[model samples]
Target: MTLGEGTHTIIAVAMGVDGQEFPSAPVTFSVRLALPAPQITQPEAGSVQDMNLWIGGTGADYSAQVQLLEDFNHDDYGYSLVTLTGGWGRLFNLAPGVHSIVARQTINGRQGPVGIAHFFKVRPSRLTTVNVEILPSQEVKFSGTGHNGATVVLTYVSGPNNKPLPEVVVANGVWQISAPDWENGIYTYSAIQKVSDNAGGWIPSQDFQFSFPVSTKVPDPTNVRASADYSPIFSGNGVTGATVLIRKQDGTEAAPPAVVVNSFWSSQSRQEWGPTFDQIVQVKQRLDGQESEPGVGVVVRIAPLPPVISSLSDNELSPLIAGTCWSGAVVNLVFSDNPAVHTAAISGTEWQFRRRTEFAPGVPHTVSVTQTAAQQTSAPATRTFEIRRTLLKPVIIDPANGGEAERDLRVRGDRSVAGARMQLRVDGIDTGPATLTNGGLWYIELKGLAFGRRILDAQQTLDGRPSERSDPVVVNVVLMPPQFTTPQPGGDLPRTSTISGTGMPGARVDVWLEGRDDFLLRGYPVDSNGRWSSLVILPVGVKTLQARQAIEQVVSRDSPPLTFNVVPAAPYIETPVKDGHIGGSAVVSGFGVPGDTVSIYLGDTLLGGAPVLEDRTWSVPVTLTQPDGAHVLVAVASLDGFKSDRSAQQPVVLGRYEPSIDSPRAGSWVSHPVTFSGQGRLGTGQLVSWFNPELPWAPNLAVSAQGWHGLSVRALPAGGNWCRFQQTIVDGADASTISDWSESARFEVLDPASR
Candidate 1:
């Protein structure tokens, strides 16, 4: 039960086993509210105080004791009790460096919750004569004057608090301590001198504090780099206001000292070296009379040497410019008359660049080359050379050197140099510049040349320079032969056809069959466009034909031979109608031209051939070898050596008619008259025959579509007998169309008494 802040009365009750209640005397008690924790109003948190300090706070209950707890501990040095007056209390004479104090209010053995913790620092007595020194080896020492025979205890206060230092004993009113391996920073320490009080205890005076900075060594230089100039500049980062020094690998100074500004420093060497020079050096910084350790080795490289040209004499217009240079250097070429600058990378010690455009013919040129490496350029190497005039001889393409040509001839040729014009020479007479096309092709037409053998040659000129005359093309200035324009070579033609060609205008074209001295068609006039046609009945054979043109009485050589075939008509297949079935050794008959030969074909396979009779009917025997399936057959007719096109395709079916016996099987016992059954094509008829020793010949039995119960044979010997079947005429036809017999089925025939 919780009690309120007021006076209350409670009664105790006693109960017996009989359920009767007895009441005791009433008890009265007073309930009072707990006093709130105090608030420290004087010497705020984080404030620095002197040795003789007073800490005060406000409280709600003036009659309560304000307990001040130092460093949050209840030990002898921390617990303190003080009486409050007018709701305020003070804690006096608190020793100090840094302190944390919490206050609580207590009344009648009841204490309230602790107040907010307050932290602050107390200023110890300032030591005026304290001396601090950092030795060259980074050791720190502290010394000061204190009371005679007193011992001084040191506690680290701030700045790099690594560990507690050892105590020092004062002798002759002086105390000193040395700390080794001290880092570089400002450090504050509190010193307390303790004297004997003659009661087996010592009294500690107020703290005497001191602070000092130690900087024994400067930092080493970083990020050191050098330029590729003859007198290079070395630069890096270091401590501000430090002097940076450049030194050789042997510890000798290489350049004057440079002061660091804004954490960066650079030093340029006073003396210069050759362009290809390189060296290794170190860098360091010094500040406040202390020097740092040397940095890593830095490489300094100078510019590359000038390149050397190999040679410059060549006949090619776009020649290769090659030279020797330092490995990994860029070689640059600059011409005196050309504005463009070309560059090439050195593969090893050599570099080369091919000019894209040709140099002017027979002109002197001066080219200078230089090598650059490590961001530095070298001096230029000079060379002068002239491009010699050496033009290739032109080549005549048309009007063959020893061939015949027409009087009004067109001369064509090609030049080695592009965009060069050609000049023609006929019979040692010069013809002005001709038409030149892209890709170095040139042509010129000469009209009405003398009707005799003529000499033709040409020369090419470029950029006002002439090339050597070409090898002379000697041609006969006569009428040119006609070229066949119809009935193309390797084509099939009818016996009566027209042949046409092109020749010189108004020329008389004479056409002749090959191997015939006499002309087949004479005096065919060519039209203005050099076209002529002749109608003739060609012989029924493959023939070669040629034509020649004659303007006057002189006839020119024959044209290129044109070969063609005069074919006969395609033959018609009279037998074996479309989609019909044929068996072994079937005869295929067709109708064709009287003297032509007809060849039968099954798919692409040749069957056999037969000549057409005088009555125009032909027949050929073909033994079918293909499996039983549908196939296509075609007929072609040939006369002389020319064959006609294939006739209309006739799709047909082929079958192998050998049948197998399934009942009274091979090697089985059977009675005198046995039934032979087998499987065969549904539309085919089967013929069964047996070899019996008692009979000279066995009769053939025909069965049509009987499936597996097809045939029965009688009169067998009382021993082993063999029987076979073959497909005879399909659809129950006669036996004239029979296939080869199948393998014999051997079976034992039992006599009637032996069954």
Candidate 2:
């Protein structure tokens, strides 16, 4: 039992124990039961308000209920526990006052006070306001006062239908209410009230309104007109970017406007790339985002020209190497138009043919192959198959009667169109024609054709009647005028260099370093992008540079000259001493270039110091010393700042020495590895040593965690009880051992069955 405020006591009858036998004896002891220092743990409102109080502690008698008095300090302060059980109790719905929590326990007709009392403040009572966010058909989150056990009601009349908006009970303080999928509209909720407020009385607040968003899609295109374009005819394909105009009724092919789909605008015609035709092109076009009617064929697919080589793949007739004797070497003529090459002529000093592996004996040779690709186009690509061999031949040309022409457009034709000396000419330009190649075959090509019409020339000598030329074909030339676009302000040169431009590709585009020599660098042809890019190799002492592209004309602007220093390479030391000694903590430096990496080493051992600075300067203290004797210290530097260099060996005596193991509790089961560790500075040379026990007459033993490490080990044949371990350290020429043969720990390596 406990007193209302002071000390209290408990009484009981008990017995003393003697060999588990109880002796008849009654005893009464006062536990001095203080309600373990009272602490108002919860209700952390900082101050008490209305009516709320919580008192917690230990050591309270479960037999008695606690009593709390309000206004204990005479200043209208009060406290109480109408629902007290054990020592934990909470009081809520309190009045404004300074309150204290006091409890006392009484037992066996005795009583004492509770540990301590507490104070709190409670002002007045009112409702708390909250800004809740949500919509009738949408979900939102909320907490505290009006949550859970809360009855929320929302009222709203559906538009037109004159119905109510669908509502759902809230869960986890979140509710979902949505109207049918709609088009850009707002959901209005007139009134929303929380009937079951977690705090008490019902709370009716304002309603929420939410907006439903609508998305749009692309619309069908109309009134579409075609746009003109140009492209290079690749080796086996022709340009195909021609377009046609389209409209719902009567829109001219030349004039067209854009269309709109849900406020988004799109052009009338859109084009891309597609297949090729016979040395010609087929363009496909359509209104952007619009599908053409079936059978209308309104899309444009432009054909891009094959890659250009600019110049022959690296200058050299035959697989040129260092040697001079190229009697038999296969040489492929180079051209800006390669891979899909259309023509090759074999003649002159380059005639003999040899594979890459073959070495030339003495004479020179050349070999070429002509191939015709079968695809979207009917153009026949020709390559000369020749071998420039010093060895004479019957001049065995495929079509002996037909020889090669001076220009790149010569074609030795075959039947369907056969006849001797077939007159070869296109657009009125005569291409020297030859006879029917050996076997009733004729050869010819469109020679010197004026721009526009493309046609293969007839095969005929200047004297005879010219053979009729193939069907006249239409062709288009690519022209992308290289414009000097003011470059995006060039950042520091290193970031971006060598500019580019466009012009007649394959034409040697000269490059010049403005205000410098012209012969220095001739710019190369612009790449497919109508542009060129190359590194600006600055001369040794020159830190500034500028460049311009000579594509037809200088199309590059002056680049600002920026100054920056080149990072100089560091120096290093080589050659290390075999056996060296250096005082630990002494400045151990290496020999190397001033700006290189220099490292310190005690002979083969490295003291590993921080990298040396640019001045070839580096210093580190060598705190480690060794036993006195003939010892050498060395310093090695490295070429790369990272790697260490060779050594600068210095022979010197280290120190007088004495070293040995101290403690590990002789003959212990070796709980932790039997360590032979002891204190000692570096002598001339120190070596901590341990030995393995012998099994019978055998000397070899397997020690676990070997050398310098105090590791444990088992005898070869497993176990035989008595195990011995030892260690030793040597300094300079002095050596000693620490082992236990007289008193060694005996441990049994239990067998699986025993364990």
Estimate, for each residue in 1-755, the C-alpha lDDT of model 2 and write its tens digit.
Answer: 34455444444545556535444455444344343333344444344333333444445555543444342442322333322244445334554334454555444555455445555454322213323333212233222233333344545433322225453444675454444433333333343534322245433333433222232221122222223233221111111221222332233231233323332222332333233232222221334343333412233333222221122221233342111111222223332223333223324323323234332222223322322222322222223222222211111122222232222233444432222345444445665534444323444453333333343334332224333444433233122233333222332222223444444333345444345665334656656544555554433222433434433332434334433322222332222222222233345543334444455665677766555665334665666554444566655444432333244445544532333333334433333233333333322212222232233211222222222223333222223344332222232235221221222334333344433
TM-score of model 2 (CA atoms): 0.17
Candidate 2 RMSD to the correct structure: 41.1
Clashing pairs in 1: none
Candidate 2 has an lDDT of 0.35
What tens-digit string does per-residue lDDT give for candidate 1 at 206-298? 555578887756768778898877778889887778888788978788778899887888988888854645588878787887778755578
Mark the regions of model 2 whose C-alpha exceeds 4 Å error after superposition: 1-28, 32-163, 168-178, 181-187, 190-207, 211-755
The local distance difference test score of model 1 is: 0.73
Best by TM-score: 1
Error of 2 at 205 (Å): 9.1
